[model samples]
Target: MSELRDTELSAKVKGIEVTVTFPLAHGKPFHAKQAPETTVGTVRSEAMSQFGIQEEANSTYYLTHGGSRVDDGATLASIAGESEAVKFTLVKELVQG
Candidate 1:
């Protein structure tokens, strides 16, 4: 786990705010501001790096929003509705199960 930052991100990342939490990581959650068109896969990848989680052959990491598993291809705009921020939880499980 890493520290959750209250960032004043530059103009390059001014669209929507994103925060991601791990079920059992050490520190705080991952936080950033990203463009509305950013994909869930992108967020997941960055969050993984921030939390120092590695990919595993037997496991698959996924993102969930509002208790429902979110598709990697989905964009922030699709999930955010009329809001300017979004939150997600990161979880890992057996790939074949």
Candidate 2:
């Protein structure tokens, strides 16, 4: 039952201030406070717990941004830039073995 600290984010969507909450797999929600420097892999790791996914589950997931797949080494800032909010979709990678 780990609790994530609440973070307030300010973003302007279409000239309106909006607050967005990012939901994790574990029912815990978080904001993109450190998203500018955070990598997709880091976010994925944090979300694994929410989905009851084990690190060694022999599965892989991808975080897609702006209709494109983000690389593990890419930072959120690189994808969203200074946008008020960014949408990320968690997709399970299909195993091809």
Candidate 3:
């Protein structure tokens, strides 16, 4: 005899800030400020890379675009919000009977 378990995937990425660093043509240490021009997916990839997390097929994150928040079937390419440090909170619950 055995039992079964249930589980789901969901997440929210908040406090997103893309920092760009560069040096002058003269090889001087310098820096610049600019918002990330890439998609949220790319941002996730960047974060994962920063943390040395390999690509896993069982991981996902919730997203909000222009006040429209969705948990599934959305991509960074479709985000319509202005470029800024956007915050998001993810919520998940089991279907009620």
**Please, what is the TM-score per model?**
0.82, 0.59, 0.32
In model 1, what is the error at residue 74, expressed in angstroms? Answer: 0.3
Candidate 2 lDDT over 28-78, as tens digits, reads 443345445556687766655555666545556777765577787865555
RMSD of each: 8.5, 9.8, 16.5
Pairs that clash in candidate 2: 25-50, 26-50
Ranking by TM-score: 1, 2, 3
lDDT of 1 by residue, 22-87 (tens): 977999999998887778999999999999999999999999999999999887777775478999
Candidate order, lDDT descending: 1, 2, 3
Off by more than 4 A, model 2: 1-32, 56-58
Off by over 4 Å in 3: 1-36, 57-83, 88-97
Question: Which candidate, 1 or 2, would have the higher lDDT against the true structure?
Answer: 1
Winner on lDDT between 1 and 3 is 1
Instruction: Pick the lDDT winner.
Output: 1
* Predicted structure with the largest TM-score when compared to the true one: 1
Q: What does candidate 3's lDDT look like per residue over 38-85, in tens digits?
A: 344555444444444464455443334444554343333233233334
